[model samples]
Target: MTRRRRTACILAALGAGVAITQTACGGGTPSAAPSTSYDATVRADSPALYLSLGAGGPKKQKQSAVALKATYHHAPGVTSMPNGDRASLFDGTSQYVEIPDDDRLSVTTTGELTVEAWIRPDALTFAKTDGAGYVNWLGKVSSEEARTEWLARMYSRDNSEARANRISGYVFNEGGGLGAGSYFEDRVRPGEWIHYALVINTREKSDAYPTGYVKVYKNGVLRDQDALDGYDIVPSNTDAPMRIGTAAAKSYFKGAIGKVAVYDSEVPESRLAAHCRAMHGTPREAAGT
Candidate 1:
């Protein structure tokens, strides 16, 4: 209404405009604030590589841990087998080649990682119920018989029939505060080849509400993804051999397995796709439904 008031109002509006522009350019007040950003990136080429094992590749057993190999042949640390076929599981009716110790694989990691393996489970073997039998950090246990393992699965444990045709991942920690983890089936489908992967986050401790986890992918789709909790801290330098098919039970896998790999880090989806593409056979359409 007055000349002075109109002049003051114009100055105020101009000042506000300047302040907003300054803030947008990150030059306003010197407030202590955290900032972040996101970017859309299209990678033309990736430098990452996948770890591969099994069938016609360099052998792991012949190089180190020969004694562990003996365990598979009904012998531990002893290299002699009467059968000319190196080693075989003879269950009276039939005999199939068990996974070789050289090929008995595992990866030692404490940060983050993705592990993929091709398994051909023998018929009639039921996987652990808690899905803890196969993929888990073997913790300190009175014996391998009573170890607490971690796992991931699609169906609810309460569902009576969920375990029937479901695929699951497992982690078991036992002995001296250290542990081992793995992946397995709720029900056994013998003579059929299956591809499985375990993804774990090691940075998050189990107590902090489980930042790490394991996921089971059958074929190409995810079947189960589970968090790691209710377990003790993973022991440092736990270099226990990565045993497939069976764990601690001498419950070895009976059948043909190829392209086994243990990676030092969790694998990404792109890397997983590349891995699946390199291997033989089509990825099964997500296990079960």
Candidate 2:
């Protein structure tokens, strides 16, 4: 069976409370599943991806909950969270995760897309080849020869020349041009976990032809929205890989990344909050620290 079909069957069996058993082939021992109930809950969410970084070795870190294999660049290390969960730490130079380009990841003009993650930065400022700059937490883009498709980045008011600490989201067209974008000027505290989510609804009606709407959510609250401008807000297809912890080596993220999720459809605000609560505990719990 195909991977998607097998995943569906596994979820169905789990929903039905069927006890699953497996036999080792060729006299090899069967691999053990996650031991915690919370892990099971996360797996059942069925995100297009659920990457639990720093929870395991490099090989296992690349394994997605939905079976999509990811690759690590420059070898990020594991770190501990306040809740005892592990997170992958990126060094501002050359650490990030790369997800191979796939058709499912390419957002079209009529498709809905959601990207969410939990991040804790060491510092907002980093030195680049040209000069000092901020970091892009996650994004997908063509090679330097091509334009960026989308990016969720952290920048400063002075455009990284100085540290003002702002978070922004951008959507681009095929030729690597900006389409729709917005930024939140909230100050990001170092070493504190924050939930970030971005939703894109390309089917929404807009005055601009062939463009759609975008929303930025920080910790379950809507922070910004804008209508995409370009005629090709998102290409019908792309072969550019989705990147985490950096975008095309420009702004490498320097911090710990816990959970990363992608949904083919826009997730409800309530549901997004619930997911954050599940992964990071309550806001009250966070404030206590």
Candidate 3:
């Protein structure tokens, strides 16, 4: 049936307290490059979860992962415009979702990790008011210690220079508690299926921190890349479920989320390409009905 409904059904069957893992597809050619694939845990007879945004949403692919508790699609504290259909999760005081519901996946990792998702970004209404648009892709917890690391997420903002240049990408580290660090922008459009990733590699050193990076792919092709070497942030454990819609209460995403995949290791380009090719029609990054 529909993607959301299919996932819901699978979640129902699997029941709570069951730990679902992302595994390799059976009989499928092993990706030449290193990659990790995640599918929802289901009964052998259950259908696949392969739904997307535009059409009836994503469909049920044979391999899909069930979302755990506190995974909110639309909760309170966030506002949705009249024309929008999806609900966002902004804190009552701020316009962002940077913290977890109960601080479940706040562990720090010592090595590399990857983040992926299918997002339809909405208009940046709070850009002017807060000087920061929506950055609900992903985020880490707030650190009280000055030496604590950070792994924030990306979002889009309006460029006053050009009307067509309506969207861009940026990140905030915990160094300044969401105020410090260099904030970059992307020359991309909103309301479409875009693939974005943040890869942290390299070893930590006394002189310099390990090298990390950020990249954006429009419909599968790599459009932007950033080398964030010397920056270090504690990562969540392998068991931590990836946050899709909103990272915290303040930076809730204002759009429809179709699919999300998390790999313990870096995902190969071939697999990413396959996922991009599987994508269907365009989706507006608008609030939900």
lDDT of 1 by residue, 42-129 (tens): 0112212222222222233432222333123232111101100011222312221233222213222336545555444343433332
Q: Estimated TM-score per prediction?
A: 0.47, 0.75, 0.48
Write candidate 2's Cα lDDT for 69-113 as tens digits: 777777788876534466788887877788877655656723877
With candidate 2 superimposed using the best TM-score fit, by how many Å does residue 212's alpha carbon deviate from the native?
Answer: 1.9
- Model 3 misplaced regions, further than 4 Å: 1-67, 73-110, 124-131, 142-156, 159-190, 203-212, 230-243, 281-289
What candidate 1 gets wrong by more than 4 Å, as runs, is: 1-109, 125-162, 174-189, 204-210, 230-236, 281-289
**Residue 55: error of model 1 in Å?**
6.9
217 Cα displacement, candidate 2 (Å):
0.5
The TM-score, computed over Cα atoms with residue i paired to residue i, of candidate 2 is 0.75
How are the candidates ranked when ordered by lDDT, highest leading?
A: 2, 3, 1
Best by TM-score: 2
